[model samples]
Target: MATMPSIRRASSRTTRGSAVALALTATALSVTVFLGGRTRGPAVSLSIKSPATSTISNGARCQSRGFRARAPGVSVNLWSGFGPSLGRRGLSMTVAPKAQVVELVSRVVPAVVPEDDVAIKAFSSTPSEWKGDMIIIPVYATPKPEGAEEGPNAELTGPAKELDGVLGGIISEMIGDASFKGSKGEKVSTFVPGGSAKRVALVGAGEKDKENSDTVEALGASIAGVALDAKVASVLVVSTGSQPDSQALSSGVLGKLYADDRFRTGDNVSKPVKLKSMEIEGATSDALDAAVKHARGVTSGVRLAKDLVGAPPNYLTPSSMAGVAEKISKDLGLSLTILEQEECEKLGMGSYLGVAQGAIEPPKFIHLTYKPKGEVKSKIALIGKGLTFDSGGYNLKAGAGSMIELMKFDMGGSAAVLGAAQAIGKLKPDNVQVDFIVAACENMLSDRAMRPGDILTASNGKTIEVLNTDAEGRLTLADALIYAEKLNPDKIVDLATLTGACIISLGNEYAGMWSDNDDLAAELLESSKDGGEKLWRMPLVESYKEELKSKIADLKNVGGRAGGSITAALFLKEFVTKTPWAHIDMAGPVWDAKAGGSTGYGVRTLVEFVAKQQ
Candidate 1:
């Protein structure tokens, strides 16, 4: 089994922070960069093949190329394509009748990491030391005098110029010929002859002033995408910017490459996740290891959440949700307590149980806790609305714009919370105690399902009139909020795919945040911004609570259509008497149809919120 590289982190991060970012000062000294045209070969496709008698230094038989198909139980990993040359077009692979070829491939590829686990050491590594497949250099476009060519001429940075000279000016020539604009997410690749690396790619990046943690992370994701296109196993990222950038780039890279192909078969399988390792050039050692560790934690957490949210409702019931939580707690060494339906009834959790009445799947009230070893500086609670499925009960969701077909993601909030739990568990950040709770269940339509106008009592002893059975998320959260408050944590935050009104208000890019506490709201905002998750604070209007006023009950589950998101927040506010609380209605961003996947949106923002706590 492969073990993590020994961390040679510098004494204190404060010392490395002064090194001024992972700035690609390529030559160790600052110099001007240029793309002046000179004689050099263009990026081209190549094919490389080896003799059958050839054997790798590790005594494993391998090839320069591989087939898309693998024998049952066969795997192709990091050492997949370390042959003499980069193969393309002509050298296609076919499935072997026997397991000999695959077995040989597996021999070269060490099973150090279980396929799902992950980083780029966000530190300096000279090109001479790397015998990797590709090197991606991110260049930003700077304004300059208009020239007689494609888009305005790019003003190369110091690192770009140094590498251009080292690579024999092929990068500059490729940029000019390809009209490479250093805009975000843009990429152009080229081949190198007698260069520092085998193949090279110059990707577009945002300007110096526009660079931040989020943008840097986006840039990293772009670099990973380009590398995947190149189909290379290892890469060296020539990082940009002049700030302390660690976790952002690594998370963005691995997160972008994340896939849930568990059920895929034959050609339906996603990419092999072939890109194994990445190294950051010219970075501080401490920052690099720190970045790798945090990025793996957060992104893996995100992948876990994505897998859950992407799963079909039937495959991820309340029982299975609790099962998954159990596995996470056991694996991460966190304390766990699962309350069954009967147990919940004894505690008066009528509001939460009401939604589960119609489903064959029993309700699971899950609590996973992470306690610091010594002094606990603070405590916080994270709750996810774990509605495995929502059929809208008597208020069957049906209309011109019904999302009932995609209701599986109604539990995105729960996915986010648990995802953050996995990350926090792995990181084990000191001095903060975190409680993760999920009231897992399904809201289905049946004779036993709660009907509209039925009154349900929450754990807090407050009555709620279920005027719209579709507003079931708030009902589940009402009980959770009350349950979270009982713990007496420093604060509480709950996420739910609770309202369509939020999607209409904020679109799919941002989560609607509602909190009465100014400090809590601001703190969360900063975290989201840093993590590259969009969040907008909606007013917790006191007057909107009138819309939820019920004649027969203390409150109605929903309010009038106008400012519906605001009223949803107000409805949840009733459960909390003290302990700063915030509600995130992440409806639109939960499931991204365009990307054809779940966003796993709240993990980073939530992790930042907890980790930043003193």
Candidate 2:
């Protein structure tokens, strides 16, 4: 006996001639529509005026001055103003699903609260003029040190030399007193006696020649962690290199400075540190400023992703995940399309919905599209596994090491997709369009859950055998890949926390990547290298498909334990017909024990790839 939920919409009825038009002004976009809750409930029906033919751009209505039905979701607002007067047409239209309203509508949705805006000042001022609550100098260790009888002290050079002189040689004095040999990951912090800075620290940047974006990013992260631990509001990073990376430095600081306190209750709520501002002495160019803006956008996406992935399974169900997508579309001016269970069934998404059969939460297929006003030179599709929670279905994930409780992050792929969408939308990269899709659902245990030995058909008519219900992400992605391919995208890339074997193979620092095209893999690798996110390209051996052969159906979900990640990629490759597609097995790097929360791993790489695409 479930309680019937209430549905209330505030669109005023406007009558012209003999027809009724639903006024979908920005204020009238207040809709709290839900088809159903966790349990069964009657669907909320919506009837609007005739769909408008007007165009929608930048979240605003066009010539017709109303919403239009281009695709699904609220991309064109509520009522599309067609023929100057939708009310005069006397046409009635019925929209399914109540809550999934307003795609790319001109509405004021609450913005994602990013980490406190740490003002980054790229000043023309020299190191001598640098004054802050703390100063961090990244130093590289001596040339050779493995078997030396005594390692020589690190020399003060470049910005370190200039800043040390201004601090009355305190940095050199301390290095000598403590015998501080600058080894990688080494750190020494001390209070400044009468210097402009309250305290100073030297962070090891490894060998000078070996210094790369990863080490520099690490340096930035270390500075942020130290600044917060010391309660310093402003810090200056003295660069030793000729030109500092605005993106890498800011990303490291912002990413490391973040912490998730979502589940914290009263009294347990943790107040974040007072890190208000960071100054980089050598990043004083206009290009640097632009990079800083772009870096902030990337990290902002990362934070959004981290927050979504960090949510508990109970709090972020499939329907709720759609809600989050709708909010993102509304806030970021991205066109959105959400297909309900019925729509999915019509498209023969049995493989995707089969995984959702056991859950009370209905699967919500989400598609978010970002279109540039200029001529589209290329189109890209990004897909994510939207499993909010996975209980292993009837196969049942139970044991001492099941790690089932942590399955809330099974949706990390979807989080990364939406995170990247948020970034692409806000940054507004021109000449390229990106479509973000997620087949959001859960794999919970119930009497209705899909069982082993069940054969499910995908929309592409390809059949899948349920050999292992535990392997459900590929089932959802099977349908999503087909959907993405239909868009005729030039490139399609998907990210998923797919396998434990990936973690075993690559450890927790790098994500395994598989691609059909070598050029796409190289591009991703290059972008990842620039972003300091580790991506290891794995093999897509055609021979691996032999492992997926099923006796009754087209293929089996899981292929034994040998090369599990490779087999998983091979399975997803079946759904692709024609597209330069790449699959990322991110189970290893999705969670960083050191980052304090979800690492938001795929965001920076994906954003950089799409934003820079010609």
Candidate 3:
């Protein structure tokens, strides 16, 4: 039901057989072409003729000269010289329609409206034109009017709202009602549309008065999401209008497509799929080239995280996770160190080891460092709770809580940290020092599992009263945070699926962030916004710290369920000596059974924060 406008180009066709022959000979140096000629055997010479100069009349015989058939039933249509610019590759020929050179060129050229400044618009596609394989869209670029206010258009009023309503309404009608929704009060899509050939999409840079590159990137992501759902083998996105540069649009769209499929798994066969090839039309040779490369990089990073999180717990235990880190270190030139139970015992990590005691697999305290190639301005340490699987320890989860069967996502925090390290390694930012730490273990039930009411000391030698064995995330983090403090980093950030209390407070849409340092908290908030991850800063009331007080030990792991999340932060705060630290309770964002995958929530935000620090 989406509208697709017909693309138009200036008519300028020429028949130059010699030119075509020369170009073909030049191309032959780098490519091999088999052709059919007078003899039954292979032809001695092969050459292509220029496109026949004529009006694109329907069903017209468009023939080229000196084109030797590569194989039986092979046909080639030559057109005017239209090679892509340096660093930019033209759209793959596979997505082009099988027609005469004139018709094919006419159908695929850029579309422009005379004197119109709009960057995005909706067009109707006729049923006869609906090939249904893939939809090709043209995006144009328009500069925003000077003095325009910055922010999302959803925050506009009066004239802006009226204008947006018209534009949004047109887009809604083109793509169909089901393709759009309001996310956080902004118009967006729910599930990426899967049916039609490239079901409804928007091209960037329409009206000069309303142009925004950020919105253009978002539109590309939206298109990619739909492409994924449609499972089209590939997509063709064409750039149009006066915008000589449409490559940014392509990059944005490809980036989103990669992000959409990043966390997916092969086990689930029910969901809609994406196309294998994406082609961009009307892009400057340079823009098209850069967009494709950027898209591939983004997709690669996303897949890395997905693979780490999707691996089964049996294959990705604390030790196995450390092994993976060791491999990455050797491959990416990172420094890796893993502390086993013996080392942890020497450091008095009783609280962390208590959780691992129940499992046959011993815990691995992992530390990974990435130092840039210049003077280090600041050092940041990231801590992830690497609970390979959580059986709730002595406090077991049953019935609905155990339905997912795979608790491997309990190590989502660790996966995120590893993913961040991978991305940062490739990016290679300058003048920044990064340390990745993970307290990897399994919270399972066995005869030796620490029981309720037992007291254990952390790496800092601080005793903790274990009221509930299920509250084990904090037990491991307590020792991990203490260990990180010894490094004296500028900032310490820890991520964990720590408490269900966070889920109760923030729901699944946002992760609950607790930090005593305002500047660090603000920086993370900004990073979250840029990364498109939802995070809300929660209060760490001093009064809440009193709830953790224990008559027998320094503090109780569980704070009687009231302000459970805040008290958990308080318990962690006790060990962080003079360091600016933040705790991301990823309990809500780690896994979503109904959504059916790990969200990879904190990875992007954490990476963006690190990049900005440079």
Q: What tens digits encode model 1's per-residue C-alpha lDDT throughout 1-614? A: 42322212121121111211111111111111111111121222212112322221111222321111111222211112212232311111111111222222222222233224334665354555567789888888664436735447455556556667776778789888977778787788877777657898888776666778878788878988888888888888764344336677777787778656655788997767778778777777786788778888898788778888888775676766776787788789999998876578779999998898666455889999999888999999999999988888888988878888898999999999999999999999999999999999999885447888899999978999999998999999988998999999999999999888988989989899999899999999999987778999999989888999999999999899899999999999999998899999999889888887788889999999998895
Q: Write the per-residue lDDT of candidate 3 for residues 1-614, one digit (tens) a residue.
A: 42322222122322222221322211111121211111122122334332442221111122321222222112232222222222221111111111222232222211221111112222233322333455444333223347864321212223222322534443335334433222211223222244334343443333434545545556666566656656556555433323323434543554543323332369642343335555443344565555444433333344455555666665566655776776568768889998866578789899999888776565789999999989999899999888988888887867775533667777777877887877677666788899999999999885547889989988777889898888898899888888888888999999887777888999977888999899999999998876667889999989888788899999998886788888888888888989999988877776665654655667777877898889
Please give each candidate's TM-score: 0.79, 0.80, 0.63
Q: In model 1, where is the ten-residue run with the lowest total lDDT?
A: 28-37
Candidate with better TM-score, 2 vs 3: 2
lDDT scores for all predictions?
A: 0.74, 0.76, 0.61
TM-score of 3: 0.63
Positional deviation of residue 395's Cα in model 1 after best superposition, in angstroms: 0.6
Runs in model 1 deviating more than 4 A are: 1-119, 122-125, 144-151, 239-244
**Residue 563 lDDT in candidate 2:** 92
Give model 2's clash tally. Answer: 7
Candidate 2 residues 1-614, lDDT tens each?
43322323433333332233344433222222221112221112234332353322223222322322333334222222223322232222222233332221111122424345588777667766667788888777788767888668878888788878887899998788877777776788899887777898887776767777777677678778788888888888887654545677677787786666555678786665688888877776676678777877887788878877888775677767787787778878999999977678789999998998676566889999999999999999999999999999888889997889889889989998999998888789999999999999999886457889999999999889999999999999999999999999999999999998999999999999999999999999998887778999999888878999998898999997899999999999999988999999999888876757578888988987996686
Ranking by lDDT: 2, 1, 3
Task: Please rank every candidate by TM-score, starting with the best.
Answer: 2, 1, 3
Q: Distance from true position, residue 87, model 3, in Å?
A: 74
